[model samples]
Target: MLILLLAAPATAQPAPVIYLDQGWSKEDREWYYQVSQGSTALSYDLFLNLEVATGQDLFRSDANSDRYGLITQAANPRNNPDGLPIGLAKTVVTEGRSKGTYVGITCAACHNTQLNFKGKRIRVDGGVGNTFDMMAYVQALDDALQATLADSAKFGRLAGRLKASSPEAKTDLRKRFEREAARVHEYRTRTLASAITWGPARIDAIAMIVNRLTATLTGIPENTSTPLAPTKPPFLWNAPQATWTQWRGVQQDPIQRNLTETMGVFLDVDLQSKSPSEGLFDSNAAISNLQQIENLLTRLAPPQWPEEVFGKIDRKKAEAGKALFISICADCHNAWPYTWTEPNKHGKRFLLVGLVPQSYVGTDKGQFDALRPYAITGQLSDQLPPPLKGEKVIPTDQLYEALQEAVLAKALSKLKLTDAQAADLHGYREFPLPPKPMAVYKAAPRDGVWATPPFLHNGSVPNLYELLLPASERTKKFYVGREFDPVKVGLDTRSGTFLLDTTLRGNSNAGHSFEDGPLGNGVIGPRLSDEQRWAIIEYLKSIPEQAGRVTPFGGPPASPAR
Candidate 1:
């Protein structure tokens, strides 16, 4: 049974409560009040603007409809008088059966917005509320397409023959099937649009194709069942609070990597690294794009908390939390600048703490695997030069440049791979943490503990209290559609949980309990006293809040010192 966290029931509006203590200086209280107010206002405005910009007709007003229509037309390649597709419009519009109507889908369709802050569950409207369920949408769409195509005697025969063939042949057949589906849908939509006078958006066409495909593939009647449920928009509030292990952090790391690697804003690209030319849109040009995003983010309204609710926070707990943070976490999980920095023994390699392990297989192989050709190839497998003589080391700068050039070359060719030699590349690269000693802006807090629920890179763990539990108690097993008993690995007494559940664990996560580390035998931290651990937690909650705009916080603003 798929165990999903149920959304909390809505409650009647209650006055906000504030909790104060002797620990809070009067000045600190005032600062909190102002910040809270500012955050609330900004959050509200930001959401409103986002809805407007995305053409979400949430209010169903005429003005909104008109605005949405105009924006949709501008962004739609089918509607464009010019032959060239502009921005993301062309790629999304031309590739699918739907001309561009599907491209106009709102961000909320995928994000699904409810999130937990502290212990309280907060719901935001207009985003894909649940991340896991997002994958189901893709599956649903694919199933629908297959069903529609199977009805044709010709297509059905082809599919049967393809499936019975070798794996390589089957792969090629599937691609052909999809291409055929796209063509059919395109013709259908064009006919419908001509009949109606107003052109149908690509999304509508795609949906029709999906419905037909689902019927063909699964032998399920499209009209016999309820339509797929809509997903809520995801919350962006306090995203910094996600645990070190959550997929959100992993997702963000890549964005940070792109920022550093390309040196500016970048579009989201597929893992296959397809469309290389398009993906490498110049970073310098991305400055304007980044600024627009930043402006929107900065203007976001702060979450509203009633004065009474704000009053309920135990100032003493928060105050002690602050001091505790400075003493313990400051060393590696820096607070002021909101970044991490640690020096190696020689101090030559300043390690950025809080980096979640990248998900690559070969990286885990001892020194031997590290030397393998596949381990270091990255995206340049096809064009990579043969191993250099004497020294196997590939200069980091050269590797970076090569990857960029290869992507550009592939983009020009519309080829997925340059050569079969490219298959060997596999290993995770370390993401450099954002520089430190920077001012605390509105980003997620890194104080180590107070942030609760949805820990890890994917928001898998529910809360800090759960994080504190010993490994055994934490190792629960459950599949996507089936329910299972929550595993008890005895983490309350131990430091880490054992990897008993194969499905829940991600790739490269084979090991003993997280508690039993140090000897390279466990998955978690060094076991600690309950008091010490909580102290660490308390310290994490005390990070100072920053109210200013986000700019680069630390490290040298100019070129690095030689």
Candidate 2:
């Protein structure tokens, strides 16, 4: 009963799913999918019975469809016990006024990826869920909830499913539904209204989280900033072992990264409370679960090229491409036998990811601009430290850092966790380097990168072939949510939902050219010929070996050799 959103005849056979060995057991995968990070999306019961605007079951309707990039899972007793797709979790609220079994978003929602290859589905556990359109999903949910509330028949249908046919029961059900519906409406308005069409596989995640922390949580309408810059969620395979995470390279600590993401997704918190006694900074963040997730991510490995499924690699072409990659791409993408530096207490070495300057890389600057300082004389001032407390303006990055710490601290305090326990929760403070706003984008190791599509931090480029072309020659617009093109090593831009117009703000595809031009502003090397481009693409599919040691690039020299 697994339904893939891909278009096909009713009599056509179901596409077989090929799950890559990304180093997760059945239990591990299940736990990863269901573990609650305390992000409430909707009440579980409501989500189960809610219908689309057309009166079709929401989960089965085109509105909740996988064609929009959100995977819809069928009922599975073990893999997906609740029958919700990866990244959606069910949890009971312990502290909030909306205390009940709620369906929330988890890390799997964005990180889990499924690629269609000639009617076959290839699942990449820790890869980017390039198909899920966060904005559209929220909007669809809002529409469904609104439809149910407005239509008496729809309301009656939902109530009947929940066994609330009695007059008093129906009244209570309506009240609960109204509250959640209002909540969903507000969220949709805040994130979707006037916001950039973050079509698929991208979001102004930091901006959204800051909006919630500064404006919504503190009830300071003036603190709000429209989410303008959307970036693709980074794949999680090697993230836990990296020196920094996120496209901006602004986060280091794994636990803090998860906490920030949880908040962005919808962690329930009361940061508006003016006094400590009023539960100021209190939240229902799943602190322990966050820690566990961090631990699990450490074991997650990037999916290697599956030759059996995706066809064999051309070693001859890959060999030639390796030389070309070393000459042009190695400095930024970092060829393996990587220099693993920054050894923590357990002697775990981290791969220092390169952070290329934005001006040079010449990708969209919206992400950097989003972190710039802004006026924030809001209720958050009371929670800030002495110097920032009285300041009229605060850098968004600094403000978010402070608030993340405060929220985590508050959550930890409520749990009565010991100092040692807290340290454990925070990944033993291994990645202690504080986050700072930098006008740079991270250059992650390109191992399983061939699997991630819609290239560039903003996801402006649709494929590696186009990415290698001069920015001016790149596709002006293309559709996402299409099947994977193994030959081109990216999305099949010919078909899909969400047409990405590169000319749009924050969607510029005008950098990282491999053509002959000025060294700066993204033209990094001599023009790569068509053969060269194809060779490199082939090499990427092969994913060549790493040396035991190599010098780092775009970062400080590797911790003086440990």
Candidate whose lDDT is highest: 2
Against the hidden true structure, what lDDT does model 1 obtain?
0.28
Candidate 2 lDDT for residue 307: 78
* lDDT string, candidate 1, 172-242, tens digits: 75575566445334323321122111110101222122222222211233211112211112233223222
* Candidate with the greatest TM-score versus the true structure: 2
lDDT of each: 0.28, 0.76
Off by over 4 Å in 1: 1-113, 116-132, 151-311, 323-328, 337-405, 408-452, 458-460, 478-504, 507-562
Q: Compose the digit string of candidate 2's lDDT tens values, residues 150-186.
A: 9999999888889997999999999989988997887
* TM-score of each model, paired residue for residue: 0.40, 0.91
Candidate 1: Cα lDDT at 197? 14
